[model samples]
Target: MSLTLPASRLRTQVASIIEGTGSSPAEARQVADNLVLANLSGHDSHGIGMVPRYVDAAAEGGLKPNSGVKVVLDTGALLTLDGQRGYGQIVGVQAMELGIARAKAHGSCIMTLGQAHHLGRIGHFAEMATAQGLVSMHFVNVLSRPVVAAWGGGDGRFGTNPCCIGIPLPGAEPFLLDFATSRVAQGKMRVAYNKGEKVAPGHLIDENGAPTDDPGVVVVPQSNGLFGALMTFGEHKGYGMAVACELLGGALTGGGTWHRPADTARTVLNGMLTVLIDPAKLGTQAAFETEARAFVDWLRQSPPGAGFDEVQIAGEPERKARAARERDGIWVDDATWSEIMAAGAKVGVRITSAD
Candidate 1:
């Protein structure tokens, strides 16, 4: 069964649990808000379902509470920030604040952030930039167990590794394109496993490297005590993009890559390399805005094909989901709810529905 509740009630419950983990009220609310926003935006894979893991990570001292970011290196148009293993919700915003300022001042800024706990949604940062009428690009790599397999390789070799780009549009919503290089995010597999659902083929391989339709192959251990792996989105092409993300976000950002074997660690870290640009400073504001608007109008003019409503842009789905979820409330499956309650219990907090 799934429990549906208002966003406000969910946020309050999640914040209470976060506070139980020794986070200040402010920090707890911030983290809770960020997680809930992910759900509101329709990416439940990156949403409140992650709280149980966060609770465990905090207890293990892998996720620091009430921590902030450290500026490791800074130039007018370049920055290197260390998250001090802080909550990514905080560190991500902090890094963007600095990067946006520099980008606005110098026309562009290149910022790399490392040592942050799961950064949740990279598109959030892009939205921040687009809200400022600036263009932004993000490359991020996960530091958790290697759950994604390379093109022809068997076992897991790397994390999902996400890439995102955001551009401002005049008289319309910005174009926000964000995606995981993997055929699907591991968290989505977890959700499927909990819900007892089978996934489409080509998205996963068994522990022995053969294709399978079971999401549990990646979500749980097999009889041999090993887990299966997820495949890239476009075979070799997506594999190439994931590799680039690992190299740039992990290695280039000075956030160490995952070279060790998979462990049972609940802490998932992230390294991000971000580039922000201001069109005003680039002297292309008028042209860029006009061209963007024209192309978006052109794209929307296409007729909807079979079983479709209309042509939509990359960001429209998320925005529509946010509006719908805000009105209809969010739902949590039985398994995820139990896990979250258990996490709260561990920290001596109790979670109950307002209903």
Candidate 2:
């Protein structure tokens, strides 16, 4: 069974739970809004379901409350930031703000951030840049756990590195492209496990390297002491992109790579490399908007194939999902709701009803 709650009410409940963990009301609200927005956008894997883990991390001191970020290096157009193990939603927003400021002044900026908590939805940062009428791209890598397999390999070797790019449209919602390199994110598998559901074929493999749809295979330890692994999205193509993220976001940013030893005392960390550009610097905004509109409109004219609806652009589906979810309310599955309740209980926060 599942419960549906209005987005605003859901955000309030989530914020209350986070605040009980020692986060200020403002910080809690930011994190809650970010997670709920992911749910609204139809990406439940990155939604409020993660609150349990966040609470655990905070209690264990792996994620700090009210933590601050610092600039480790600065060169005007290029910089690196250390998040000091703070909540990714907060640290990420600060990092992007700095990047946007530098880009506004210099026309372009590249920034790398390390030691951040799970950076919720990567597209959110891109959308931030888009709101400022700037173009932005982000590459992210995770450390401490390997949940994805390399191309042609059977075992887990890397995290589900994600890539995102956002392009601002003068009078329209920004065009955002974001996806995990893995066929499915590890969190998606967790969602499946929580729902007591099996995943689709080709999304995962068992400990013995046999293809399996069982989400439990990915979460539970097998007799051989290994867990199932997610596959790369497009064979070599996705594997290549994942590698690039590891190198740029992980190694280059000074965040340890998957191959490095884990820090048992700390929780997982994310490293990100973001590039922001002022489109106006390259050409007139008027010319750019005209050409962009023309191209997108032309592309939309393509006829749909069998078993398909009309053509949809990179960001159209998310926009549609957001609209529908806002009107219908967000759905939380039974298992995830139980987890959230338990997590809230740990911090003396009670959620009596969906309403």
Candidate 3:
């Protein structure tokens, strides 16, 4: 079952916990807000569930404290940012800002980012551009190496490979589409492990290439360096996108491509590309948004499947989740809470109970 915590309380608590990692208060706040937003959007795996891992990474010297990001290259429309091993959220926001500004001037822009840890949701970045009355697309590949297997491979040879596209929708919320190419995100596996839950067969493979329900196989080194291989979501097509992301984000950005032992790496690296466009320059912005909203309305008005409530868009589900969590509380599973508490102890932070 999901564990619930007040949204504000959770964000504050997580922000404090992140501050213990030597991140600036601003960075900590940003990271916490992003994470909490992930949870509020129903992606618990990337939400507060990541606190323990971050804390552990901080303590183990895997993540440096108080690091700052910097731009390595900028040529008006093209930019390359080096995160300097700092908080990925902070770096990601900064990178998006550059892309947005450049796109505003040039009508399109591309950015290559390096030296950051697991940047959260790609949709968040896309929405950033969309909210500013621009269209945006993003491609993300893993860093510190890849930890997922290709479609037919047993070894970890690919990242989850998430991509997103967003379009401004005027009066309504922007149209945002985001997804990971993998059958299941790595964070989902981590969440399952935290909750001691079993996942579907074929979701993971043992060292011998046999399927295993035990989430521990992905964690324990003694399992024959046993790592789980994630199936590509759309078979070859998704795998192709994943490879492309690897090239664009990893190879293009000078980050190494996937290989063995990617999981035990030092810093998370992600390569990203963002493109932004202003609809007004192309044609009529208001008309485009109105037409798009009408189509969306028609699509949702269609009949829902059995046991379903209503049809929803990519961002709608997450938006609704955030609203609900804000009123109720952010769910934190027991295992995740325990991990957070333990990690907090190491960093001179306190994890208080709901009571």
Candidate 4:
């Protein structure tokens, strides 16, 4: 069964559930907000669907509700942080703030953070920087051991590495581009399973190295959470990006490479490179703004294909979805809702649908 609830109600429910896990109100709200935003932005896989796993992790001490980030290294344009086992939303927000501050102080900044919990939806963080009038790029690798296979290989050797790019525009929403290097993110597979649907062909390979569309292939405990390997996007090219993301986000972030055998029960190590260009330094800020507006105008005015109303930019859809959902409410499927309610019940929070 599927359920639809107002975004605010859903957020409250989710926050209540998170707070039940020993997280403070602020941390709980941050996590809830991020997950809701993911769903509103059309990334359903990254949304409230993660609540169940989060509850499990909280029970396992994977998330330290009271933890905070600490600065380890700070240079003019570079910094490294330790999340101290805190929730990723809290640490990620602070890291971006540090990155933005450094970029404004210098010409650019790169941030490497470690020991954070599951970092949901990198685009949300990129949007945070973009909202601050800065350009940001993020690369995340999984050190939790790979469940996805390298292209043409059957064994798991790569994470569903994700990369994101955000470019600030003068008067509009920023241009945001984010995607997983895998043919399909594990989250999507999980969503399909929740809906009792099979995955698309070529998305997973069973233990025997044969392609399978069954979501069971990726379900945990079926093969020690390694039943099948996720296929890479673009065959070899996307596989290469996954490798590059792993190296850059892992080794460079000092998070240890995935190739190493380490216990990855509750920590995420990642890196972000942020560049903030001073329009004033480049040229006339007004001039740059004017030209960008002109270009966008021309682009939108271009002829559209059949059934298309207007040409849109990278972040337009997500921005529109966010606006609409904010006005109305976010939709929560039954399975995810049930899990969240169950988790909330543990903490004296009762969640019910609106009439």
Per-model TM-score on C-alpha atoms: 0.99, 0.95, 0.92, 0.89
lDDT of 1 by residue, 1-355 (tens): 8888899998999999999988999999999999999999989999999999999999999999888999999988999999889999989999999999999999999999999999998899999999998899999999998999989999999999999999988877889999999999998998998888899979999999999999998887898989899999999999999999999999999987889999988999999999999999998899998888888889889999999999999989999999999999998888988988999999999887752
Clashing pairs in 2: none
**Candidate whose TM-score is highest:** 1
Best by lDDT: 1
Worst window of 10 by summed lDDT in candidate 2: 260-269
Cα deviation of 335, candidate 3, in Å: 1.0
lDDT of each: 0.92, 0.88, 0.77, 0.77
Is candidate 2 or 3 superior in TM-score?
2
Using lDDT as the measure, name the better of candidate 1 and candidate 3.
Answer: 1
lDDT per residue for candidate 4 within 1-355, as digits (tens), equals: 8876777777887888788888888888989999988989878878887776677677777667878889999986888888776777788888888888887777577788776777888898888887877778888886564678888898678678888888778867778988999988788887777678887787888867788888767655455544677888899999999988888777777765677533436334444433444454454667777887889889998999899988998888888888888787776667666776776676677777752
| lDDT by residue (tens digit), candidate 2, 47-94 | 999898889889988888787779999899998999989999999999
- Candidate 4: C-alpha lDDT: 0.77
- Order the candidates by lDDT, highest first: 1, 2, 3, 4
Residue range 37-113, candidate 3, lDDT tens digits: 99888888678878887877777676666676677888988887776666677878888888888888877777888
> In candidate 4, what residue range of length 10 has the lowest lDDT sum?
261-270
Q: List runs of model 4 lying over 4 Å from the truth.
A: 223-226, 260-279, 282-302, 305-310, 346-350
List of clashing residue pairs for candidate 1: none
TM-score rank order: 1, 2, 3, 4
Q: What is the lDDT of residue 16 in candidate 2?
A: 97
